[model samples]
Target: MEQDVSLGLAIFVEHGREREAADFYGSAFGARQFQAHHIDGALAGVEMRLGATVIAVAGANPRREAEPSRGGPFFPKVAGGVSTIIQLTVPDIDGCFAQAIAAGATLRDEVQTDVAGRRVASLFDPFGHIWVLIERDASAGRRAA
Candidate 1:
């Protein structure tokens, strides 16, 4: 069944960490890869779906001074850290958060209700992407405000 994806996210990791990122997402979030593009037996790009969201993982484009108009000279958040956060709306925030931690994600914020009353938790993936796991089910037990 083909999904009519309206919008998509493309994330670029450090030049050779594409496979690792894809694999991590798969194990931690149960993402299923729909396609993987390779170059000379090396993984170049991958497309996967986590529920309704389509996420594309790829290696950062090489930094070239001449190609100033290129889509990226993208760099992974190794030092300064990234401002983008990949938020996953899941049915089991606690379980998923544990899985991500076991899969090498460093816990950033423990699971708690945010100011907006959403049950949320955040972490930094090994590849340096920040992920926020959110459980929006009203029955999931939000703290009394």
Candidate 2:
């Protein structure tokens, strides 16, 4: 038998913007920041609470930004240098997506209903963080996503 382990997701934002990212997520998810870490008096990371889920945000690090052999600023060649996709379940899909847009998020896709009967939408925050709003039909005896 294999041992099971819990996994946590972490996202890195550009340097000097960890706090902004965390706050943006807080507003978008209607959550709050419960912890934060700093390096040399500058915010290096933050952990936000969304109900029972916690997501970590890390500050930009040149060492991890681009090709090490190519040297610093590891920014991606195109948009969204990151690889993490954050999905959030909200009571109202439209309302939550609108709130995110009002908070400076760029709409990437409008809400669409899938065959599974779930409403989903995508957007990018100012820092280029990707997010998806999910609204599952719990009343259909389904659980939240």
Candidate 3:
């Protein structure tokens, strides 16, 4: 079998309520609920479509417990390293920023212009994931081309 080079991105969260967390992400990103399955008295998995990307959510399998003394070294105490940030390229950075803030995300930075002449803003979701929204001016594309 040929090895697949592309792998889907998943953010493993220690969620106290899986359904709520999934719904929050879905609403925040304007994503549709692709799939949600429950099994053996726990949330088995869920998939949400963010633009063309699919994000999977799964309950922490208690059966695969790690040693109590083996603390996570790479991950931050508040936000895990695995989920550094997710960037969303949109047509309206300001609009998306307003929507995300209204949906419960804290504003990390105000919309600012970059050297590339794109407007961008950074925000943090309730789940501790950072999201950077970028809006590239249409004229910039023409100049580049």
Q: Pick the candidate with the highest lDDT.
A: 1
| Best-first order by lDDT | 1, 2, 3
TM-score per candidate, in order? 0.82, 0.80, 0.76
Residue lDDT tens for model 2, 1-145 = 2456555667767777887878888887776787889878888889877776777878768666654776553433344555667788878899999989988888878999977778999998888767888885668555433
Report per-prediction Cα RMSD to one decimal.
4.7, 3.6, 3.9
- The residue ranges of model 3 lying beyond 4 angstroms of the native Cα positions read 1-7, 62-83, 140-145
Identify the superior model by TM-score, candidate 2 or candidate 3. 2
Query: What local lDDT score does residue 24 receive in model 1, on the 0 to 100 scale?
Result: 92
Superposed by TM-score, candidate 1 places the C-alpha of residue 74 at a distance from the truth, in angstroms, of 1.3
**Which digits, one per residue and each the tens of the lDDT, describe model 1 over residues 1-145?**
2665387888778878888989999989999999999999988999999888799999886564236586564755572277678889988899999999999898889999999888999998888888889996866457543
At residue 14, candidate 1 shows an lDDT of 83
lDDT (10s digit) by residue, model 3, range 1-145: 3564544666555534567668777777687778887886668668888877788865554444354355432222353234467888888887888888888888788999978777988987776677889985777689999
Leading candidate by TM-score: 1
Give me the displacement of residue 81 in model 2, in angstroms: 4.3
Q: Relative to the true structure, how large is the alpha-carbon lDDT of every model?
A: 0.84, 0.76, 0.70
Query: In terms of lDDT, which candidate is stronger, 1 or 3?
Result: 1
lDDT of residue 29 for candidate 3: 69
Better model by TM-score: candidate 1 vs candidate 2: 1
